[model samples]
Target: MTPEPTLAALLARLDRVEAHQAVADLMSSYINACDLAKDIDRIVEHFTPDAVWEGVGRNIEFGTWQGREAIAANFRGVQERQPFTYHYLTNQEIRVADDALSATGRWLCFEPSTIREGTLPVWIGLAYDNTFVRDGDQWFISHLAVDTLFATPYDKGWGVEMFTPVTAPKEPSHA
Candidate 1:
């Protein structure tokens, strides 16, 4: 015969479940702010004051940004370069610490972006490794490391070319 779970065990399980959901929600909110709202303030609010955002692999050119202000600047640069983007995240795995004060998460991202003043369509594949710290009841990203799998033009695809040529749009003619 099986015994019922103790009240303390049930509460612990509930806390873990809630923590997982909170972390997932935070990621979703961040993506929405970047993709849909394009609100730099909203995006930066997801991170801790001293958070570190770093890009690796094929995206090493992005470099690293530490602190909320730096991260906001990085996002602003991205906004200018890619005016439109849709980010989709999948295969998310989040593990809450036993103490429930911190967590780690991994996600795979597929992003379709329009760049060069909507003249170029590009596809970006990325892997994200993130750490979150809990402050009271709220959680904020402490470190976010993204590795780019590929960033290829839609027409050429990554199989043919690893990345699309990034060029500024031609200026309007004054005649």
Candidate 2:
């Protein structure tokens, strides 16, 4: 015979589920604001006051921005460079803490952009490792690390060279 769950256990399970869903929704909202909504204010609202946003590697613009103002500037730069952008996220992995106060996620992104005042469209492949914090029942992005794997014109796909990291060893690995 199985025993029913205690009220405390049931509430704890619910809290975890709610936190996970909230974090997922937060991610979707930020991405939609960046592309579909194209609302800078909405994008800014997703981050914590002391959030940090950083980009690594050669595939995309690289910068380390801290605080809400700096993060807003980064998004503004994106808007300036691309009049219209579409971002697709896949392979998402999200983990919420047992206490339901924080979470982390990893995602792969394919972004295509219409360059401002230009006819050419560019595409980029990126990986996002993000962290979220729960503040008074609301979740906000606390850190965003974006690693761009490849960035090229729509007509030109990534080649072998794109797959090779700039800092690779001189000799091939045996493994």
Candidate 3:
């Protein structure tokens, strides 16, 4: 007799691996876009219409943006001194849980901005406590918290936006 693989067994196997990499990839693009734009509207769409983005930004900036309007406004506020900026995400450590439906990850945040003279990059590695959602036919970050652990200023005088026709990064490689 041939062996039949049970459906429950397959799903259980699926739960063993992280399922939020796609979401992470999409989110990385969002972060990149925000840094690229002189304005924040372009990247604000990634968040939910009523999403709240709060963190210890300049002057201890932290608040809950009610919706698209509020979120965009808040980003614009922080982006005032951001014509020259870089948002780098790396060293990602992802964790899967809740039967392959939810997951979390750690991301190191780096920014190259002006401090005194020439531009220099500073490391502000932080923990990205995130929650994923299977939205429609794809995954999205339903909730994301960026907790800052370390930060320092640069001295190279961050350069103005210099991207020559930006293109989205390639999709997440599962290989």
Q: What TM-score, to 2 decimals, does candidate 2 have?
A: 0.84
> Best to worst by lDDT, what's the order?
1, 2, 3
Prediction-by-prediction clash tally: 0, 0, 4
lDDT of 2 by residue, 32-151 (tens): 999888888899799998888877665544667788777776666667666777889999899999999999999999987666434557676889999999999899999999998876
Better of 2 and 3 by TM-score: 2
Runs of candidate 3 with Cα error greater than 4 angstroms are 1-8, 11-18, 56-61, 115-125, 156-175
lDDT values, one for every candidate: 0.86, 0.78, 0.54
All models, RMSD in angstroms: 6.3, 7.6, 10.4
Candidate 3 weakest lDDT stretch, 10 residues: 166-175
Q: Model 3 residue 140 lDDT?
A: 55
Q: Using alpha carbons, what is the TM-score of model 1?
A: 0.88
- Point out the higher-scoring one by TM-score: 1 or 2: 1
Please, what is the TM-score per model? 0.88, 0.84, 0.64
Residue-wise lDDT of candidate 1 within 39-153, one digit each (tens)? Answer: 9999999999999888766643457788998888878777888899999999999999988889999999999998776778999888999999999999999999988787899
Question: For residue 38, what is the lDDT in candidate 1?
Answer: 98
Whichever of 1 and 3 has more lDDT, that candidate is 1
